[model samples]
Target: MNKKKWMRKGIALALSAVITAGIAVPPATAEANTGRIIGAIIGGAAAADEMNKQIKYYNTTEEGRQALFQELQEKYGVYYRWDLNSQLDRIFTNLTAAIGSMDATVYDRPYNYFINQQEGFNAFCTLGHNMSVNVGLYSYLSNEDEIAVVLAHEMGHGQKDHPAKGMKRSLGPTILANATGTVLGAIAANIWNGQGLTKPMEWEADNLAFEYISRSPYNPGATAAVWQRVIDLSGNNSANAFDIMSGAADHPSNSSRRDNYAKKLTEMSGGKVTVDDGDVYVNKKRLLTPAPAGGMSSAERAYFVMGNLAAAYRNGHAASAAYADGRTVMLGAQPIISCTDGDTSAAEIAALLNQIK
Candidate 1:
């Protein structure tokens, strides 16, 4: 018999994809309702040991890892889109390198990723460095830096082992500790509705993601600007699957996320860049008076421009004085931003960029 039939298994962990998707997480009320049962099942230290054991088994063993991978592939059919997959590969490679700067463990087991046909804005990095991003991601986010931020967030989940912990926390440790592989597979099949990280866990992943992106060629400002665009496109109450920006039970509010990233960006800059009111300031001087552009509002547009300037700095394109090329503000050959109506003229912003540079 093959290994699949020769050995007994347990669906102790088929994590990452379900929890990170934001498809659904049991609400506070439901969590409260299940608390007693989960608490009883955990039974303190014994349960913790069992849960950790399972996490290790699945995250470290080839069989356990493959089982989880198979489970995910079965659930979400794969889509072969060479263009999207190629883009994802490039981003994934950068993220792997970026994550390594701070988290050496990333090299222990390199990440493996694929594109899932799930037509929504979602992605997940499960146990053992296995991840999948939905094809819909490219449809919603076009900026490579912003998309990199999203992938980094999912990798954040993997780095922290959030999946297995979340699964055990929500499912109750004892439940997994005792279930046979066959039974566990049954459980994993329908696990989408009620398993995921706690609200605090979600916040932790977001913070880690910001750190990862800052180390990359991608601008850290994309971290906050991403949420701003999400709000612009979907508003605060979006119910879309894996839409982490939605003000759902599993995630912080979109505005809260944006503001949090803004704070992080400021900290990363050592207070060199800051957003106040609706404008981005550099060296305590207004860089631009933002005006509504595209589908984004004035404030929303400001963050995008802020991201551009931050990218210019991150990528070392801000070494020269700024100049206006048509409506755009440029630094040497790098285009920093396009001027919008109801905003500072491109020439004036270019002058400010030069001063700030």
Candidate 2:
């Protein structure tokens, strides 16, 4: 056939021979290499298709279920299985019930969640409804409702079958699909990383999480507040290297996510907030100046400014007049945004926010 097709055929034959002869291929063999050779890696796009089919079949087995957990444990160590388990149990149970109230079939396999001792503020959901929340989550966020939103967002990924879709996007089948001794484990362990998801996927999860918390007892405002808190916690920067939840370069900016919830909250309250370029309109009044471009894009910084206003108003943090504290602007005592060289002064932003009430 063609050069590409001819190489794929030859590699497929080699793989078939390798399988038939029962020669062990270490799980990391292909992963360690860049896959420049046709025969060395899983054929290519055709091979990726085969890998997807294999994962589909493997997902139904008990081995696949346990293997993913095993790989996670091997990589992240066993679950904490301590006080955090009870807390995680409460979170998972509440989220499960909230989600199940809408779509009961989502629980057909039921979610199995636990805590890992990882210090990075992140959590993930993989194939088969298996999930893990990092211990570092508690360090940054103590509000139960806030934590619930994070978990619910991950559950949204599981509900939408994003792990498989994302895996294809991220690694393109590659060697992960053909891996032996629980390929799903290798898939889950390597894929579903914070960066694996697309912007649309992240937004979808954020929207779904807002819907879930809105329907439940948890505060829907946390959807925006969590990011507000993150922005506040990590000032002079838009992304935090340690905060894997919203800090990854590939992940949607926390400001973008926060702004979405902010708009939803406004709609829920019968108010209006619209965005154009990097500028924001609240109740048809344009306020909240965007930071000058240097680190975070003005577009993203504009959203964060709006999200801060939403959280301040919704959670009653805007009762006091906005004021500038040094280079940072404050909504009462809470920090909103900071100023840098060639950027809008923090005092000017405070004046903008002060016009709210």
Candidate 3:
């Protein structure tokens, strides 16, 4: 499917015209409340966590998912029926079954394939293990191979236990406790919350999906194209420009993903696969520089890294500077957009960045 299709699948239910539903996740109690609104810095992160868990439970049972899927279909109408592909169903089922077999893993086979009855171009997996692919995905996709690549990506999320072992608590508080030795120690509060998986996790899932599907009948070349389409769809946002984490931990940016795929392909193929246009493809389209096949752009990569480093450093996160190289690079430039200049507190810096476009 095209980049739009991936977005639709990622947010499967809301866009379905037939499904007259609100973007609701379970609410938190006052005690655990972080006093943030959905999509807001504090509130959004918590919402993401809840979204992942609640949605997973919502789609856990066959009956539950089927009912929800049907509701979405009816609400969104036939315009979004792109995800009803039987081939995709089979492929996703097979891939999930194999990956779910791990000893330390938890698998809900029924939620393996997410299909929203809407025409929007999107698909995504939540941190709670929900996979939703919209009907519009078919229109954007060129073939089963391309579609397979996307499915593999969703599967990768589960493999990494991203849905479960997601972001670390809070570096700020953790650091304080470690430094003070129980003097003023408390777990750092989780700041952001959105149901979808983080960018790094998304990349991990994509790579795992590539590795898994590469073993199947899907075309290997199509794998590279999967990332190309993501970059193409992302536009100025860069493939990894936005936040991909589920309100926890760090994620690799789009550029990092792009470079990673190139490195991986080289390693996997024993230097056979090169990052050239003909070697990698996007949406059935050929890449100009091999685009690393399943990778993101350099500028886009810098955005997320710099953004996160700045946020962590401001939040008083211990290793913030170690990861702040992205921001450092930006600050190093003639213009000098320093993370330190923004705010000394990690939370304040995070909030400030959150306010940026």
- Which of the numbered candidates is closest to the native, going by highest TM-score? 1
Worst 10 residues of 2 by lDDT: 15-24
Error of 3 at 111 (Å): 3.1
**Residues 241-272, model 2: lDDT tens digits:** 54444423467666777777877867753464
| lDDT per residue (tens digit) for residues 1-357 in model 1 | 554322212113222332222233434453333334434444355445644666666677777677666666666777887777788888988888999999999888677677777777766666666787788877878788888988888788789887666656655544545432322332232234324576787788889888898787776778887888787777764454445422225666778888998877666555666777678888788776687766556776676666666666655676777899889888776676787676778898888777775
Candidates 1 and 3 compared by TM-score, better number: 1
- Compose the digit string of candidate 3's lDDT tens values, residues 1-357: 885454334333321211113112223332123222112221223334433443454435565456655554454443323345666677776666555554225454435444665455555553334456666676666456667767676567655655434322221333322322111111111212322346655566767765665455544444554554555665323423332222323445444555565555445434422444332222222221211211334322222232223233323442222212333322111111223332233333333333331
| Selected candidate, larger TM-score, 2 vs 3 | 2
Question: Considering summed lDDT, which 10 consecutive residues are worst modelled in model 3?
Answer: 182-191
lDDT of 1 at 118: 73
Ranking of predictions according to TM-score: 1, 2, 3
Please list the C-alpha lDDT of all candidates, in the order they appear: 0.66, 0.62, 0.41
